[model samples]
Target: MASDLKVHSFEEVAKHNKTKDCWLIISGQVYNVTSFMDDHPGGDEVLLAATGKDATNDFEDVGHSDSAREMMEKYLIGEIDGSTVPQKRAYIPPQKAPYNPDKTSEFVIRILQFLVPLLILGLAFAVRHYTKKE
Candidate 1:
Protein backbone atom coordinates (compact mmCIF):
# COMPACT_ATOMS: atom_id res chain seq x y z
CA MET A 1 0.00 0.00 0.00
CA ALA A 2 1.32 3.40 -0.93
CA SER A 3 1.51 5.95 1.89
CA ASP A 4 -0.09 8.40 -0.53
CA LEU A 5 -3.20 6.22 -0.90
CA LYS A 6 -6.09 7.97 0.84
CA VAL A 7 -8.80 6.05 2.64
CA HIS A 8 -12.49 6.68 1.91
CA SER A 9 -15.61 5.44 3.68
CA PHE A 10 -18.17 3.36 1.80
CA GLU A 11 -20.78 6.10 1.97
CA GLU A 12 -18.27 8.59 0.56
CA VAL A 13 -17.40 6.29 -2.32
CA ALA A 14 -21.10 5.53 -3.03
CA LYS A 15 -21.95 9.18 -3.74
CA HIS A 16 -19.62 9.30 -6.79
CA ASN A 17 -21.84 6.86 -8.71
CA LYS A 18 -23.07 8.25 -12.01
CA THR A 19 -22.34 7.80 -15.68
CA LYS A 20 -20.08 10.81 -15.77
CA ASP A 21 -18.69 10.39 -12.25
CA CYS A 22 -18.63 6.72 -11.36
CA TRP A 23 -16.38 5.00 -8.86
CA LEU A 24 -15.95 1.37 -7.88
CA ILE A 25 -14.55 -0.52 -4.93
CA ILE A 26 -12.93 -3.86 -5.71
CA SER A 27 -10.84 -5.83 -3.25
CA GLY A 28 -10.90 -2.88 -0.83
CA GLN A 29 -9.38 -0.62 -3.45
CA VAL A 30 -11.30 2.45 -4.61
CA TYR A 31 -11.04 3.43 -8.28
CA ASN A 32 -12.24 6.50 -10.13
CA VAL A 33 -13.40 4.97 -13.39
CA THR A 34 -15.38 7.92 -14.71
CA SER A 35 -12.93 8.58 -17.50
CA PHE A 36 -12.62 4.92 -18.42
CA MET A 37 -16.39 4.41 -18.83
CA ASP A 38 -16.61 4.80 -22.61
CA ASP A 39 -13.47 2.74 -23.17
CA HIS A 40 -14.69 -0.16 -21.03
CA PRO A 41 -15.41 -3.19 -23.21
CA GLY A 42 -18.30 -4.09 -20.89
CA GLY A 43 -19.58 -0.55 -21.46
CA ASP A 44 -20.36 2.22 -19.00
CA GLU A 45 -23.45 0.47 -17.72
CA VAL A 46 -21.39 -2.41 -16.36
CA LEU A 47 -19.11 -0.03 -14.50
CA LEU A 48 -22.05 2.14 -13.45
CA ALA A 49 -23.91 -0.84 -12.09
CA ALA A 50 -20.89 -1.88 -10.04
CA THR A 51 -20.85 1.39 -8.10
CA GLY A 52 -22.23 1.90 -4.53
CA LYS A 53 -21.07 -1.49 -3.23
CA ASP A 54 -18.10 -3.79 -2.89
CA ALA A 55 -17.52 -5.03 -6.47
CA THR A 56 -14.86 -7.62 -5.66
CA ASN A 57 -17.04 -10.59 -6.54
CA ASP A 58 -18.34 -8.92 -9.68
CA PHE A 59 -14.79 -8.15 -10.74
CA GLU A 60 -13.42 -11.59 -9.91
CA ASP A 61 -16.36 -13.40 -11.49
CA VAL A 62 -15.42 -11.89 -14.86
CA GLY A 63 -11.91 -13.38 -14.65
CA HIS A 64 -10.16 -10.23 -15.86
CA SER A 65 -6.87 -10.70 -17.70
CA ASP A 66 -3.49 -9.66 -16.37
CA SER A 67 -3.48 -6.75 -18.82
CA ALA A 68 -6.89 -5.71 -17.52
CA ARG A 69 -5.59 -5.96 -13.97
CA GLU A 70 -2.58 -3.87 -14.91
CA MET A 71 -4.80 -1.28 -16.59
CA MET A 72 -6.63 -0.79 -13.27
CA GLU A 73 -3.61 0.97 -11.80
CA LYS A 74 -4.25 4.10 -13.84
CA TYR A 75 -7.75 4.33 -12.36
CA LEU A 76 -6.79 3.61 -8.79
CA ILE A 77 -7.66 6.52 -6.55
CA GLY A 78 -7.36 5.18 -2.99
CA GLU A 79 -8.26 2.42 -0.61
CA ILE A 80 -11.70 1.98 0.95
CA ASP A 81 -12.30 1.68 4.67
CA GLY A 82 -12.82 -2.08 4.87
CA SER A 83 -14.74 -1.79 8.13
CA THR A 84 -17.55 0.12 6.39
CA VAL A 85 -18.04 -2.30 3.46
CA PRO A 86 -20.60 -5.07 3.93
CA GLN A 87 -19.23 -8.60 4.18
CA LYS A 88 -20.46 -11.23 1.77
CA ARG A 89 -22.96 -13.61 3.34
CA ALA A 90 -22.16 -17.31 3.35
CA TYR A 91 -24.53 -19.73 1.56
CA ILE A 92 -27.01 -21.44 3.89
CA PRO A 93 -28.98 -24.40 2.57
CA PRO A 94 -32.72 -24.02 3.10
CA GLN A 95 -34.42 -26.33 5.61
CA LYS A 96 -36.40 -29.15 4.01
CA ALA A 97 -39.91 -29.78 5.37
CA PRO A 98 -40.67 -33.43 6.14
CA TYR A 99 -43.06 -35.04 3.62
CA ASN A 100 -46.59 -35.52 4.96
CA PRO A 101 -48.55 -38.20 3.06
CA ASP A 102 -51.85 -37.24 4.66
CA LYS A 103 -51.61 -33.62 3.44
CA THR A 104 -50.88 -34.43 -0.21
CA SER A 105 -53.48 -33.89 -2.97
CA GLU A 106 -52.27 -37.11 -4.66
CA PHE A 107 -53.47 -39.10 -1.67
CA VAL A 108 -56.98 -37.56 -1.84
CA ILE A 109 -57.16 -38.06 -5.61
CA ARG A 110 -56.19 -41.71 -5.30
CA ILE A 111 -58.90 -42.35 -2.73
CA LEU A 112 -61.54 -40.57 -4.84
CA GLN A 113 -60.57 -42.55 -7.98
CA PHE A 114 -61.09 -45.88 -6.25
CA LEU A 115 -64.36 -44.91 -4.52
CA VAL A 116 -66.06 -43.13 -7.46
CA PRO A 117 -66.20 -46.23 -9.74
CA LEU A 118 -67.33 -48.46 -6.85
CA LEU A 119 -70.04 -45.90 -5.94
CA ILE A 120 -71.33 -45.79 -9.55
CA LEU A 121 -71.53 -49.60 -9.75
CA GLY A 122 -73.40 -49.82 -6.42
CA LEU A 123 -75.93 -47.20 -7.53
CA ALA A 124 -76.54 -48.99 -10.86
CA PHE A 125 -77.09 -52.33 -9.10
CA ALA A 126 -79.48 -50.75 -6.58
CA VAL A 127 -81.56 -49.19 -9.42
CA ARG A 128 -81.71 -52.49 -11.37
CA HIS A 129 -82.81 -54.48 -8.28
CA TYR A 130 -85.52 -51.94 -7.30
CA THR A 131 -86.95 -51.78 -10.85
CA LYS A 132 -87.21 -55.60 -11.27
CA LYS A 133 -90.78 -57.03 -11.12
CA GLU A 134 -91.61 -58.70 -7.75
Candidate 2:
Protein backbone atom coordinates (compact mmCIF):
# COMPACT_ATOMS: atom_id res chain seq x y z
CA MET A 1 0.00 0.00 0.00
CA ALA A 2 2.98 2.28 -0.43
CA SER A 3 2.38 5.48 -2.41
CA ASP A 4 5.84 5.81 -3.93
CA LEU A 5 5.44 4.52 -7.51
CA LYS A 6 8.76 2.82 -8.10
CA VAL A 7 9.65 2.29 -11.75
CA HIS A 8 12.20 -0.47 -12.23
CA SER A 9 14.86 -0.30 -14.88
CA PHE A 10 15.32 -3.14 -17.37
CA GLU A 11 18.68 -4.16 -15.97
CA GLU A 12 17.12 -4.84 -12.60
CA VAL A 13 14.36 -6.93 -14.16
CA ALA A 14 16.88 -8.88 -16.23
CA LYS A 15 18.67 -9.89 -13.08
CA HIS A 16 15.64 -11.69 -11.74
CA ASN A 17 14.36 -13.35 -14.91
CA LYS A 18 15.30 -16.86 -13.84
CA THR A 19 12.80 -16.77 -11.00
CA LYS A 20 9.93 -17.66 -13.34
CA ASP A 21 7.06 -15.19 -13.30
CA CYS A 22 9.17 -12.79 -11.28
CA TRP A 23 7.19 -9.60 -11.54
CA LEU A 24 7.94 -5.93 -11.05
CA ILE A 25 5.30 -3.71 -9.56
CA ILE A 26 5.96 -0.19 -10.70
CA SER A 27 3.94 3.01 -10.94
CA GLY A 28 0.94 1.23 -9.48
CA GLN A 29 1.07 -1.29 -12.33
CA VAL A 30 1.73 -5.03 -12.51
CA TYR A 31 3.23 -6.58 -15.63
CA ASN A 32 3.64 -10.32 -15.92
CA VAL A 33 6.57 -10.27 -18.31
CA THR A 34 7.16 -13.97 -17.86
CA SER A 35 5.81 -15.04 -21.24
CA PHE A 36 7.77 -12.31 -23.01
CA MET A 37 11.10 -13.38 -21.55
CA ASP A 38 12.11 -16.24 -23.83
CA ASP A 39 11.19 -14.50 -27.08
CA HIS A 40 12.86 -11.15 -26.37
CA PRO A 41 14.98 -9.91 -29.28
CA GLY A 42 17.59 -8.69 -26.83
CA GLY A 43 18.52 -12.33 -26.17
CA ASP A 44 16.53 -14.24 -23.59
CA GLU A 45 19.55 -14.91 -21.42
CA VAL A 46 19.87 -11.29 -20.41
CA LEU A 47 16.35 -11.20 -19.06
CA LEU A 48 16.55 -14.77 -17.81
CA ALA A 49 19.78 -14.08 -15.98
CA ALA A 50 18.39 -11.10 -14.13
CA THR A 51 17.01 -13.46 -11.58
CA GLY A 52 17.78 -11.88 -8.24
CA LYS A 53 18.69 -8.21 -8.55
CA ASP A 54 16.28 -5.34 -8.02
CA ALA A 55 14.35 -4.79 -11.27
CA THR A 56 14.06 -1.01 -11.22
CA ASN A 57 16.34 -0.94 -14.22
CA ASP A 58 14.41 -3.38 -16.44
CA PHE A 59 11.17 -1.40 -16.32
CA GLU A 60 12.95 1.76 -17.35
CA ASP A 61 14.62 -0.11 -20.22
CA VAL A 62 11.21 -0.68 -21.76
CA GLY A 63 9.95 2.85 -22.13
CA HIS A 64 6.21 3.21 -21.90
CA SER A 65 3.79 4.89 -24.29
CA ASP A 66 1.61 7.68 -22.98
CA SER A 67 -1.55 5.58 -23.14
CA ALA A 68 0.09 2.31 -22.13
CA ARG A 69 1.86 3.93 -19.23
CA GLU A 70 -1.39 5.41 -18.00
CA MET A 71 -3.08 2.01 -18.31
CA MET A 72 -0.17 0.30 -16.57
CA GLU A 73 -0.78 2.40 -13.51
CA LYS A 74 -3.91 0.42 -12.71
CA TYR A 75 -2.08 -2.92 -12.28
CA LEU A 76 0.47 -1.86 -9.70
CA ILE A 77 -0.42 -3.19 -6.29
CA GLY A 78 3.12 -3.11 -4.89
CA GLU A 79 6.59 -4.47 -5.71
CA ILE A 80 7.57 -8.11 -5.51
CA ASP A 81 9.69 -7.66 -2.42
CA GLY A 82 10.89 -10.56 -0.33
CA SER A 83 8.10 -10.13 2.21
CA THR A 84 5.32 -9.92 -0.33
CA VAL A 85 6.75 -12.38 -2.84
CA PRO A 86 7.52 -15.12 -0.37
CA GLN A 87 4.19 -14.77 1.36
CA LYS A 88 2.34 -15.14 -1.95
CA ARG A 89 0.41 -18.37 -2.01
CA ALA A 90 0.57 -20.77 -4.91
CA TYR A 91 -2.46 -21.45 -7.08
CA ILE A 92 -5.22 -22.51 -4.75
CA PRO A 93 -8.39 -24.35 -5.70
CA PRO A 94 -11.65 -22.51 -5.75
CA GLN A 95 -13.42 -22.64 -2.43
CA LYS A 96 -16.91 -24.10 -2.38
CA ALA A 97 -19.54 -22.36 -0.33
CA PRO A 98 -20.15 -23.91 3.04
CA TYR A 99 -23.52 -25.44 3.92
CA ASN A 100 -24.91 -24.15 7.17
CA PRO A 101 -27.88 -26.02 8.53
CA ASP A 102 -30.54 -24.21 10.47
CA LYS A 103 -33.01 -26.80 11.66
CA THR A 104 -35.98 -24.49 12.27
CA SER A 105 -35.54 -22.55 9.06
CA GLU A 106 -34.72 -25.66 7.02
CA PHE A 107 -37.83 -27.44 8.28
CA VAL A 108 -40.05 -24.57 7.25
CA ILE A 109 -38.30 -24.23 3.91
CA ARG A 110 -38.66 -27.93 3.13
CA ILE A 111 -42.35 -27.98 4.06
CA LEU A 112 -43.05 -24.97 1.86
CA GLN A 113 -41.09 -26.53 -1.02
CA PHE A 114 -43.12 -29.75 -0.88
CA LEU A 115 -46.45 -28.06 -0.15
CA VAL A 116 -46.30 -25.64 -3.08
CA PRO A 117 -46.19 -28.34 -5.80
CA LEU A 118 -48.78 -30.46 -4.00
CA LEU A 119 -51.10 -27.48 -3.65
CA ILE A 120 -50.84 -26.75 -7.39
CA LEU A 121 -51.45 -30.41 -8.27
CA GLY A 122 -54.53 -30.60 -6.05
CA LEU A 123 -55.90 -27.40 -7.53
CA ALA A 124 -55.42 -28.70 -11.08
CA PHE A 125 -57.15 -31.98 -10.21
CA ALA A 126 -60.11 -30.12 -8.66
CA VAL A 127 -60.41 -27.81 -11.68
CA ARG A 128 -60.35 -30.72 -14.17
CA HIS A 129 -63.03 -32.70 -12.27
CA TYR A 130 -65.35 -29.65 -12.07
CA THR A 131 -64.87 -28.87 -15.81
CA LYS A 132 -65.58 -32.49 -16.81
CA LYS A 133 -68.83 -32.51 -14.82
CA GLU A 134 -69.89 -29.22 -16.39
For lDDT, the strongest prediction is 1
Query: 37, model 1: CA deviation in Å?
Result: 0.7
Q: Provide backbone clash counts, one per model.
A: 0, 22
Superposed model 1: Cα runs more than 4 Å off: 61-67, 105-134
lDDT of 2 by residue, 6-96 (tens): 5455444434445356554443244555665665556666655445444446656877468755654454534543433323359989998
What lDDT score belongs to each candidate, Candidate 1 first? Answer: 0.93, 0.57
Q: How does residue 114 of candidate 1 score in lDDT?
A: 100
Off by over 4 Å in 2: 1-30, 61-78, 81-134
TM-score of each: 0.66, 0.30
Cα lDDT of model 1 by residue, 33-114, tens digit: 9999999999999998899999998999999999999999999999999898877799999999999877798889999999
